[model samples]
Structure formats: structure tokens, C-alpha cells
Target: MGLKPWQKALFPLRSVAAVVRLFEAELRQPEPDLVLLSLVLGFVEHFLAVNRVLPTNVPGLTFESRPGPDPQTRLYFPVAELSIVAALYARFTAQIRGAVDLSLYPRPDGCSSRELVRKVSDVIWNSLSRSYFKDRAHIQSLFSFITGEEGPPRVPPGTKLDSSGVAFAVVGACQVLGLPDVHLALSEDHAWVAFGAGGSQTAEVTWHGKGNEDRRGQPVQAGVAERSWLYLKGSYLRCTRHMEVAFMVCAINPSIDGHTDSLELLQLQQRLLWLLYDMGHLDRYPMALGNLADLEELEPTPGRPDPLTLYHQGIHSARTYYNNEHIYPYLYLAGFHCRNKNVKEALEAWADTATVIQE
Candidate 1:
């Protein structure tokens, strides 16, 4: 039977309680510092992607992936965020050209590179997070000195260069900014953000290797294409696929037990499920929401007065997916989820609906 009005009202409240308890349980988990760091980095990466500090074509750099409860595991983001961040960074690096010495820190350790890259990314992210970058001139100044004269002709495909496609995207970004291209090498196995092109002081990205450049066989103007893709395709490839993997891994992996409570993960899943529902994805099958609730049931309940209230809270507290507006996936999932129910039969009767959407 459908829930009475009173029961429905209680539902959202119960969800909220579940969320709070889950959050508290998560807080109580060991090594809270690591979890906080992951959240910070995740937020930083999300901001960078949202603001275009990185490139979109590079593999293993997307913000779509959620950090797992396991602190030891690192998640990779996709190219869309990377492309945007790289473009913004390229612009900033262009401005800081002469002022900052790239040579002093050439080929630094992975941690150093991550630190340096994170710093610049953070600057752009923080600026946007604070909503303070009021003018283009300030942005231009940030990138002016970093861009230099033209560098080596575009790196040939077959030949390995110390620069990744993301680096060149930055180079191409310099071109976009009218800054001369700069060339420099970063250590292999990693993408580098360094200074020195052909013109005056310039910065370059150099780190060529498998999974670093665009292996998808995108065109030479690929950098331009990548920028366009990031600007247009909010759920670029990595966010779509890689993110799923990260979540799936987090959900299924049982080996890394103590650091993150499984029940909290289930609670998180419930929250995600409701978010999907609120977005109209689960309108056809309320049971899918029930599926998530069942999962969250595995976790021990907190001191909250009602379990349902906690669940709704968790749903409200979960982060929104990268782009929640576009509805293709929602429609697809709705169709799939309702296949055996009344919704499915109705959809089948209105087969033309699917065709119309495709057209």
C-alpha cells in the first residue's frame, strides 16, 4: 500500500537521521585526517574541473569519482576537468612566466609535482570557490609571464616526448591566449607543468607516456577539441566511465575493512540513490530507492529517533553528481528499472517516446 501522508512526511526526516548518523560514524572511523584530506583534495579537484584548471583529454584525472572509504586507495579523475584546469593553469603559467623559475624545480618528485600542481589548481579553484575573480585582466596577469615564445614543432606522434597531450593542450592554450609556445621536459611516467617555450619567458607541459596523451586518436587540433569538449560535454569520458569504476570499487571491495565502515558506505549509496530519484531517474520504480534502503540497513543505526529519518538526511546530504540536468541517462535508467513493472508496460505502449527523444 502507498504510504499515508503522515508516513510520507516521516520518510524524509528518517532519511536525514540516517545521514547524520552515517556521517558521525564516518567521522569516528580511524584516521579521520586522511579522510578529510581526501575530501579536501576531492573538493579541490572538483573545483579545478568545474573551473577549467586542468585538461579534459588526459587519462586518470576526472572529478566524477567519489573518494572511497579506504584511505589508501587513490582515485583518478577524467580529462574534462584536466582540460579545463590545464587551460586555466596554462593561462596562469603564461602570466607568471618570468617571475617564477621553472628550472629550479624541474623533475621534482611525484609528491612535489602533485603539490605544485595542486597549489596552482587551488588558486584557481579557491578564486572561483570564493567567487572573486572579477576581471579578465587579473587572470591575464596571472598567465602573462608564464607563456613564452614558440617551442619545438608539435611533438611527433610515434616519438615519445617528456610532454603529455595535456601539456600540449596547455601549449595550445597559450596559443589561444596569444602567448608564444614554450617547450620543456617533465619526468617520464608523469605529466609536468613547467616554464619555457620559444618566445620570452614561457611555461610548458612535458610528460609523454601511455595513458598521458590522448590515445583516442583525436585530431592534432585535439587540444582545441578537448577544450571544446570540456566546455560542452560536462560528463566527458573519464567522468562517465572512470567514475563508475571508482564507485564500484568502493562499493564492492571488502579487503580494506576497518578504515571505512561498510554500513556508512551503504548509507552513502542510499543517499546517491535518492539523489537519482529526486532528479526523476527513479520515478518509475520506487523500489530502486528501496533497494538502496535495504543496503543501508546493514549498517548499525545511531541514537537517532527514527531510521527512515536518517535515510532521508543522508540522501539530502550526498553531493550532487557533476551534471544533474541532462536527462538521457535518467531516461535510460528509468526505462531499464521499470522493465518488469507497470512503468515498463506503459513505456512499451508509448514506444514512440524513445524514438522521438533520439531524433
Candidate 2:
């Protein structure tokens, strides 16, 4: 059944218009509009038929928004860079279709719109899933569900530690676990994770590292004389393969409970060492050495030996950081191993290390 002339004439252009309209609608939202547009545009370029122009109302071209970690990180394309890419793809793709029609499909242009879109989207998606927005949304959801009950109202940006500050709750857990070797590594540019076994694996818990920050000049804070944006440009955030190996090991260990029993502690520590090695950190002596050093530095609090032994200890410690989700893994480590006698001192130091999140 040969198609009617009018039907063929309208299909391709209508499809192009529909995709463009979708981009326009997405850009109006407060969230990462550009990131969403990039994904959608890429899809259109790679898969949409080019023979007929379709309107912007086509349902197939629309992508449903998938729930992800709050404020998820994807490829950090500058607004201008993204605008250019999306606009070019949209325009050129339609042009290709028009050209193909003129040539009677016997020989379409060498560069198909669909093929180019596929290539670009694939690269963007891979970089995004690994480098940013891995499992942040789920962590946020879990946190809200656990702690949103009646309390001294929780504020946004709770505790402010640049990237490496440990959540206060974890420090309290340290007191409970009696493991002096656990401590948070503070940095302004990146979030990092490092532990000596016995932590939670409900999601991807990885440490962030400090990549050098480029100078923007001057401290914007009122009291401080120095000011600069704590931004790292062209910095690639990555976890060594060992982190994954560690993640898997921690997931199966039975010693990761909150009881802090001696038998469990021994097993957890043994399992942790194996994970650290799997993460390729066996030769990276300093990180492990640092953990031990942190353990030794905890000042013994007279009364609060098992800081986490008390239920309130968790609340008090968590008070130090606004959003406590980032450090849940560390809390699991400290809570599972630390004993009551010396955990308080470590908890105090961890508290002092964190900066309260500012509005």
C-alpha cells in the first residue's frame, strides 16, 4: 500500500517540531534542564525517522523523568556549550531529512542524524552515571524516611564540611565502636570515603578526594580575608576499582551490625582489609596509616566512653551535620566497632572538624 502524498509530506517535519518543543518545555523547569535536554535531544537524533516532519506533540519522543539522587551530577557542560550542542543537533537533523527526500533515499548523506545523536548521547550518559549522580537520590530518600519525625526542626545545608568532612553522627558511632582508626578526611573540593571495614552497603558509598581548585580570588565570607570559589574545573572525579571491590565485600559481611560485639568486630576488620586491598589501596600506605593515626588522636571523654551506647548519642552527633546521608557508611564503620570507653573523645573531635552549613 503506497502512502498518500500529503501524509508523507507532513510526517518528518512534524517529528522534528515535536522534539524541539520538548526541549523548550524542559528548559523552563528549575532543575537541571540542560542535562535533561541533552538526553532527550540525543535520543531524537539517534532514533527518530528522518523521512517525514512531525509536530512537537508526538508522544514517543517524550522521555519520562526517572527519579535519581537529589541534585544529581551529570556531565558538567556549560550552559552555552549545551545550548549550542542541542540547537545544532535539532537544526541539522531536520536539514538532513529534507536533503534525503530530495535525493530520493537512494543515497542519503554520509552522516545520518540518527547516528551522530547516538554517539554523543552514549558518551554523555556513561560519564554522567560514573562520575556524578550515581546513587545520591536514593540516599536522600532513605535519610528522610528515617529521621523526618518530630525533633528540633532539621535545617537545610545542615552541617557544612566542604567535600571531605565526616557527618557528626558517624563520629558518635566511632565512640560506640571503639575503633580509633576511623576519621573523616576534610576537604573543600571533593567528597571522599575511606574506612577500615564494617560499614553499610545499602548504596554506593565512595570517598571523594580533593582535586586542585582554580583561583577565582578572595574569601566571600565576612570574617575571612581570603576569598575564592571552591570549584575544581576540568577535574575528573573517580574511585579506583578497589572501591568497587570494597563495596562488594562490605555488602556480604555479617559483622556490620550496630551491636559492637567483639566477635563481630574482628570479622568486620578482617573483611575490611580485604576490601581495601581489592580497591587497589594495598600499596597506598598513607590512607591506611592515616586511619590509624586518626584513631590514636581521639581524646578519652571521662563519662561518655561508649558514645553510641546511648541512643541520644546518635542524635547529638548527627546534630553536627545538616544532611547526614553522606556519612552513613562511616557511621556504620564506627558504630559497629567502637567501644563506649573512648568513643566520646573521637566524636568530639569529629564534631569540631565539621563546619555548619550556612544559608
Candidate 3:
């Protein structure tokens, strides 16, 4: 989507020029804030394809792929520079409180470059995770699964840089400094930041090497075969094609086994089956329902509950919780049956749904 007029007004190209000037002037005797800001601006400039720095003479840097459960694009940085950036970012967060006012650029309300970076990180992180996960705890658990850790590290909470954290921080810092062309590409294996206008205008940085030369040709591995459940503030059904959903499940329940069946799982699967039916993906409904059936036959264990019991219990909970709105499930179910030529079943489901809606 195109940037709104207000967003463009908030981040004008002139802001980039101002930061570039600051970066050039402060290259010598660079303050922590200035250095961090400079790096952020530089990346933004590179993303824009502006010839701010000559290619042959650019500073020597080492490129590293971001480590996480999800797929991540590679990041290139000057060796040993991240420590300084991280420390500055931490200091910046200590000074700022509340929302970042980007209009006051170059020195927003006398906030230093360090403060700017922190503010940017806070803004971007909050926006990105708003609907996907609950809080830092969710992020922590997701990070742990990606790293195969028993749990997230016990770091005293404040701004500390890690492999996964720095990318978002950098993106946020760059964004506030007037490079508003950032985009995030999320997939089952990894998530990475991209730059430029989306569609034909979008561009992403990649390391060119022997093995990486054919990166575009690499095939994406399929996720779970069966339909999966996703629970946030509300519950939803997801398909294997839903890479982000699959990634979230694996991250949150890293050790979940046996079809990933649970009360939540069964409900989600049923929901997805109905959705597929409603969306006219008739061929997928049976496949999804079959997944639910498979779950039903699996023996109940301490962790893996009986699918049949969970299915009924889930429907009861949905009806009790949603009451009038509970027709959503039946609506999808009716659609599924109708599409599959089961006229009687469709009518029965629709009747139940209409009763609830009418009441």
C-alpha cells in the first residue's frame, strides 16, 4: 500500500538529507548517538539505491544471517560495531517516554541520536507484534524455539542487543530518520526486512556468494500437512499454506506432538474446514476434516487430548462464549456441506445457524 499523505509528511526526503549531513560531519569523533544514527541512515540510503557511498570504496563489513526460528534475511555490518550500537540504543531508551514524534526530526525535541534509535525500535516493534503475539513473553518464546533453547535467556530486561533484536532496532531507527520504505516479508522458515515500495518497486538486500547465488531458486518446504489451530485473543483455523500460522505454532509449542491435537487445535481445525468450504475451496474441506478425524482416533494422553471430546467441548465453549454470534461456525459448516452436495446436512447446519442468528 502507498504511504498515506500524513505518513509522507511525517517522513520527508529532506529528513534523510539532514541526517546524511550530520553523519558526514560527525564521522570523526562520532558520539554514540551519532554513530548509531549514521549507520541507520546509511542502510536506508543503500536501500533507496542512492549513490551516497561509492561501491568499491565502501567500508569493510562482515555479513551474518539473523539467527531465529523463522527465516531471516542476512545482515551486513562492520565487525565489532554492533556492541557500540547496542549500548547506545540502551542509553537512548532510558531517556525517551511514550510515542515518538517523527516530525521533530534531526533532533526531535532535543532527543539525541541514541534516543532516536530507541524510539524507532519501540515504534516498529510495537506495530509489528500488535496482532501477531501478546507481549514480550510471546516474542521470547518464539525466539527460544528458533534457537532451540529450553527457554529464552534470562537477561535483565532493558534494551540489550541480540541477533534477532538488532534487525528490528535497525529498521526502527532507520524509519524514524526518514526512510519509510521498509517492509517485512514473513514466511514459515524465516522473516526478514525489505525496503522500497512494494510490488514492482520493492527491493531486498542479499549476500552474493557461491551457494547463495541460486537463493531465489530454492524451494520452500511445506509446513504441517494437516489443518492447525491458532489461538490469540480469538481462535482461528489455519492451513499448512498459512506459513506465519504454522511458524507461530511451532515456536509456541515447540515440543507438541501427535498431530498437535488439543481442544484449541480441534476447534481451530474445524473453523478452518468451514472457512475453506465458505471460500469455495471445496477440494480442501474433506482433507481438513480428515485431519480432524485423524486427531479423533489418536489415543488420549496426558498432553494430547482425545480429539472427539475436545471437538464437542470446543463447540460448547464457542456457543456459550459467543452466544448469538456462534452462528459463524455453523455458517461455515453449512457452506461446506452444501458445496459437497450433502443437501440434507447443509440444511440442518443452516437451520441451526439461522436459529441462533434469529434469537
Candidate 4:
């Protein structure tokens, strides 16, 4: 059968446009219909299948092919899979919306948008896993659809962290910590923070922890052993080990030696480290304080009025500066101490940080 020239050209264009418009419209609404969203995604899948754009073995629930009396074709999703998608979508959207609404309520700790997205993804994954015991790939596709990811969920090579989640979390942490000017630099397997013109100042704050077992079946311990090292201006500062303390020293180094450039460097480093910790990279604390102890061992930079005196002065100045920040670091330090079995110090730190928070 021969088709009209205009019909062939316009049909595919209209089909693609419809799918795009459906998603665009759905996203603009505060509360979109989950069933409608699922239908739109299904429509896209079907369109791809009809046009032979998608490979035959693509992961996800397959639409049963039905031959019609006429030349026209259509796609049909399994009733069971569609039901699961709708249910999962409803649960995810409700929880996400609730978390966002609750963030408005007064509290010392606030939730970030990245956290909200994670919460939603977790809930959806859990719900789907519980309901659909098989077809992991199909479940992932459905998840990707609801989360607006291009394809199935994947952990990037050479990293355990979800790049999308980390990127979003870093941005959210910056906004929360009042460092709006800080920018994120992302690569295929890593992401970090950068500040200043041309990103002259940079910090790698992403977590790089080893999981339970390596390829050799060796037990991989977490914490400092699994901590990823950070670089500053192509120089290995070992800042990842004692991220917070490193930032403090850097921030106050200028006060010690009267160097404007070092002060700016430290300030940017401090902000980046704070965002990293707040974004749930908690295991770096072991290395963080350890790095602080090694600070005195560093060689004195040129033009310092008094090398020994300036080093001590910088340490003291950094401590005082951090102390004035309303006990934020103390709370984290308390957790670090507790994790390291310093119960007495943890208790004291917690008590002090709590008092500040209460006031």
C-alpha cells in the first residue's frame, strides 16, 4: 500500500510532538496525574516500537502486538504492569509533596530538594520492589520515567555514588549553607565544587567509600580507609582527611600570615567542605580531624613574619572563627567523636551544640 507524501512526513512528527507536549504539560503542573504520566511514557515506548526505533530486547514490560484488520497499528501495555506503575507513582508523589510541604515548618534542620528527590526515589523503589518481585530492569525503567531520568538507573563506572543525586545534593547544600556563588564541576564519574573566576579555587567533596567486598573478596572497611582524597589547585592538600579542620586552617591562614589570597582560598575551601558534609558525606570526618593534627607539620610558606607563631596563631584563629558559627561544626564533631569511641568528648560536644541550637 502506498502512503500520501504529507501523511508520512507529518505522522511521525506529530507523534513525537504529542509525546513531548504530554511530558511538558505534566511537568508544569504542581500535581500531575500519575496515570496520565504513565500513559504518556507508555505512548512513547509504543511509538518507538512501532517505528522500530527501540531495539527488540529493550528492558521493560513488553506491549503485546495485535494485528488489526486495517493497516494501522497500536500498542497495548499489560494491565498488571500499568497498575504497578500507577500505584508506585501515587506513593512517590504523595511522599515527595508531603516532605516539601513539611520543610516549610520551623525546624533547626531543614530538608533539601535533593533529599526530597532521594526520599521519593527510595520510597518508589521500595514499593515497587515489594510489589513486583521480578523484572528488575522493567522496574528500573518505570523508576527512571517517574524521576525524569533518560533511561534505566545506573551507578556510573568507577564510583558508587549516584552522579545525579550527588549533583543535586551539592547544589542544594550550597543553597542551604548560603554559598550561592559556589559552582559544581561534574565529570563522568566524579563531581566537585569550584569557586572564583575561572574556577581557580576548587574542592572535591564527593564521598568515595569502599563497599563491603572488593573483587578479591577482601573486607573493605569504611571511614578513613575508604575516604577519597581531595585536591586543591592541583596541589595535594590531603584536605579530604580533615575537611572541616582543613577549611578552618585555610580560612584563618590569612590572619596568621596576612595573605589575602590564602584567606580567600581558605574561605572557599571551608564552604565546599561544609557543603560536602551536609550533603551526607559523613565518613570523611575520621580523616578530617586527622588532617588537622598534621597541620603543624606543614612547611611554612614564604614571607611569613614568624612561621611558628603564625602557625599557632592560625590554628587558634580558625578555632575561634568556627566557634562563632552557632555550633554547627560542634554537632558534626560530636558525631565524629562518638563514631570514633570518644564518648566523653562526644557528650560534651553534643551538650554544647544542643545548647546553642536550643537558644
Candidate that scores best on TM-score: 4
Q: Report the number of backbone clashes for model 4.
A: 4
C-alpha lDDT values of all predictions: 0.31, 0.28, 0.34, 0.34
RMSD of each: 20.1, 22.9, 21.5, 22.2
Residue 84 CA error for candidate 2 (Å)?
52
Model 4 per-residue lDDT tens digits across residues 1-359: 12224322322222333333433343344332323333334333323322234346544545444453357955332222434444544543454444444344332433223333333234333332112212122121233334432323663212111322333333333433333334444321234444434434444333333331111111112221433221211222212212322222222222222232222223323333333333433232333332332232233334422323432332333245333223434554565567668899889878876664453
Candidate 1 TM-score, true structure as reference: 0.24
Q: Summarize candidate 1's per-residue lDDT along 1-359 as a digit string, tens digits.
A: 12224322321212223333333332333211111212222223222322334446645444444455588763433322324334544444343343334455444332223333333322322222121222211121222122222334872212111223234333323222222222212211222233322211212233224333322212223332453322222222111111221222122212123353333234444554444444444332222433444444444335422334433332232214323222233333344336536586446524533542343
For candidate 2, what's the RMSD?
22.9
For TM-score, candidate 2 versus 3, the one ahead is 3
Write candidate 3's Cα lDDT for 71-126 as tens digits.
Answer: 66322222223433344344444323235675554653332343444444445343
Question: Which residue pairs collide, candidate 4?
Answer: 241-287, 241-288, 242-287, 242-288
Clash numbers, per candidate: 63, 41, 6, 4
Q: Give the Cα error of residue 38 in candidate 4, in Å.
A: 8.8
Q: Which of 1 and 3 is the better model by lDDT?
A: 3
lDDT-sorted candidate list, best first: 4, 3, 1, 2
Per-residue error for 136 in candidate 4, Å, reads 9.2
